[model samples]
Target: MKNYNKYARSYFMPPKTSMKWMEKEYVTKAPKWCSVDLRDGNQALIVPMNLAEKLEYFQLLVDLGFKEIEVGFPAASETEFTFLRTLIEQDLIPADVTVQVLTQSREHIIRKTFDALQGVRKAVVHLYNSTSVAQREQVFKKSKEEIIQIAVSGAELLTSCAAETEGDFTFQYSPESFTGTEIDFALDICNQVLDVWKPGVDNEVIINLPATVSLSMPHVYASQIEYMSEHLKYREHVILSIHPHNDRGTGVADAELGMLAGADRVEGTLFGNGERTGNVDIVTLALNLYSHGIDPELNFERIPDVLKVYERITKMKVPERHPYGGELVFTAFSGSHQDAIAKGIKWREDNAEPYWNVPYLLIDPTDIGREYEGDIIRINSQSGKGGIAYILEQTYGLDLPIQMRESFGYRVKSISDHLHKELGSAEIYTIFEQEYINLNKPIQFIDYSFKSGEQFETMIEVKKDGVIHEFTGIGNGRLDAISQVIQSQLNISYSNLLYKEHALGTGSDSKAVSYVGITNESGTIYWGCGIDVDIMTSSIKALFSAVNKLILDQ
Candidate 1:
């Protein structure tokens, strides 16, 4: 707060106003996505990736459907130059994909950058010069005219180089810090480059306007992009592009709004990795469109694989809470959120909805290699009955009765709260088995033989306190008969027994799972579960489980 006097707004607003981009609610189509992961992302790493890693990353970008990828500033380093040459000399560059290389306005750099592109089928020779007022006054210490000449000279050099180059080449010009530059000056430099390249429908030039430091809000950047899109010379021949960094944490927003403002392409790194705060996240931008019913054209179906490779090569961990890509992004830990998500998932499965309208989830996690049972309804102290029950039904096929689910939910929450940790599906299953299923503490099951006559006659043998006993009882059903034998012989008084059963799955190995609930003398409820190959045995076991719970509590 005390340093407020030191900061001032460095971004410039366009001179005229036509806020047409504000009218669009969402992006209707995917932009031409150019991944700068190798160039922008690599440079930002604490330990920049080696040549081998760069090659792997380049291949990954191709696999992910990037048509244009900024490989590196080939003229800046031997590694960068070697990487470019490796792609060309090894014939790794795909015929359809174009590799773009960055270069400054200087001649030798431009010349060496051009040399690296020899034998390539197609390449983009990108030229850039800083045109911001701050760069002019402080960094470059040059007048506006001098800056314009630097860009003009670079354009001229690219023209001469392209004439002699062996590969098919396209020109791209960026007023590097476009957002901080005056609109008129940025427009002038780009048009001058266009005048030299003479871009047409067949060879459209990309005029990338980069928010190099992201000095303003996203809307201001959108207005600047609109101004550039409207005023750039040879409008139809230009692919208006934006490269937004995340200094203000709005890179995704800037790219989306810029596309709505008539820009045709977006140059960003995956997961927003780049210098300073980093470039816009192409993954988020693309998936945003995908969630809105538009095709992003990029395959994110296996995002975990992508994340593994990205982390291994980049040496940067994707935050657990990062949008779409993080591990816990789809997981719900809050009770209310879990409940709604559980209900939403069940509704979708039962109704066969055409669209993804799951609660709290913008897109189905399964659409990107995440599961609902394991990844969606995570259990913690805040988890609820719906979530616990959903996990049971989805993971283990143990659909508890509603009342039993509520009772089991509180038991799970209490355990998780005491342990101070989240419970996984397997852990929850273990707890269910240990605490409720087929429990025979204090009273144990030995043998049961039933004969149906005027009523159900059952003879059951049980062991308690190292003693074996036998009892006979009659009731309307086998479970009721067992309950009557236990209450009458053991004096374990309980009533209002409720039971439900279903096959765990189909086929010979399928087992019956039964749940039982009973009310004790104190009006307190106890629940239990049983699993067995025989439905009758499972129902009997469930009754005993409920009795064991009641006895243990008493």
Candidate 2:
């Protein structure tokens, strides 16, 4: 096993050569996209999604303008059959969209599949049979001739069954695992099916050839697809389709190249979730077109909501690093990446066209409903003042002096590494208040006392500047009481200080950090933070911290 692992590692370790070839074969547009999220994605699930979840996901696909969706294989189970019946019975199937069902050539299953789609407006019955040598030898123990017979027979049965349906029915046949199949034999089987079905110019038949398992390089796969597409006898009457799996992690490349080779349709799941590595990511492929200034005709702004529904229904967590939709996909923690993204975003904002031509941002985050403010900036051990100051400048538009940027960057690095978490905007304000703004401020909270209950009356005392100032005030809560006490003792108005509290950790014992931002007579904004187990105390401290900073700056 170890020796085989080593051999596999060595085989894949070679530097990728597909990038150079990709540029040569690049096309301006993509083909029609079909989502197999319902069928293939469900089949790969440890616990399949229920009917309600399927309905929600189906609605999402419809909303995204997918004209063709593989709803499921009705012949597999009673659950699947009922789901198809529900779509037909509830009249949920859209008029323009076509629901596709997968089945083998067996007469009984094909009939059952048709029965499940009795009232659908338009649907496609996709029939497939194993035609590759390994599948024929190991699974069916059939010869090439026998396999061809099976495929032809299945296609004939599907054609006969669909003829009786009220809706406009289309036929699709796949020589399953066609990439490794003998080219001549595969072509012969496809021709036989097309002949039996007799699809004409008005009614076109689809022959989807899937690289079910990627056994060769992407170029070889493209060559195989081109071979069949060019040699097909009734090319004018056929809709060529390609389904590429990412077993070699090149499903996207293979699908793209297949389109370049004249495949009319592509199939995959969103975020590439499916059997094995996964089917090609339709989201990635579609957005890839959008990035190149072509309309992918898909709305990605609704992707996060779709992801929420899918995650709930599938009972799977979308990894935080998944492309486009992931939490951290646009975040850059490395200093170099942050610096570049920061500059790029600024240039794009300043000029009529995007500036700096950054290496990281392929598409702007705002195009997909993500916040552009915090999208590029992240804090870690390797981060620098440029990244920190960029975040502040971008988020709040506060241009920090160079000296202040360096000083605050050191403080951010110090406490951020100690906490081992990315410092949020409030945290940044806190560090700025403590390190730069309030450097020599004498106002300090030595200690504070607060008592509150159902009665709602509170008393407070605070020590500031080495002097203990005690004041008793009655109010709704501890924070209000403290504010009243400070107002009376210090003879200063703090009506402009706005305090907001956020939890700092999980569970009952977690601390709450309060952020306070105040505008004073000079109209300068001051921000501060306070952390404590008691939220009221935290709020009071944060307000006082902001006030102290403002006074010190004066």
Highest-scoring model, lDDT: 1
Cα error of candidate 2 at position 284, Å: 0.9
Best by TM-score: 1
TM-score of 1: 0.98
Candidate 2 similarity to native, TM-score: 0.77
- Provide the TM-score for each candidate, comma-separated: 0.98, 0.77
In the predicted model 1, the residue pairs found to clash are none
In order, what is each prediction's RMSD in angstroms?
A: 1.2, 11.5
For residue 227, model 2's alpha carbon misses the true position, in angstroms, by 0.5
What is the C-alpha lDDT profile of model 1 across 1-554, one tens digit per residue?
Answer: 59889999888889899499999888888999899999889989999999999989998999999999999998899999999999999989988999999999999999999888888899888899999998899999999899989999999999899889898998889998898899988988898889988888888888999999899999999999998889999999898888999998999999999999998999998899999888899999999999999999999998999999999999999999999999999998888898899889889989999999989999999898888877888999999998988888888988899889888999999999999999989999999999888888888888899999879999999999999999999999888889899888889888888889999999999999999999998888898888899998898888889889888887
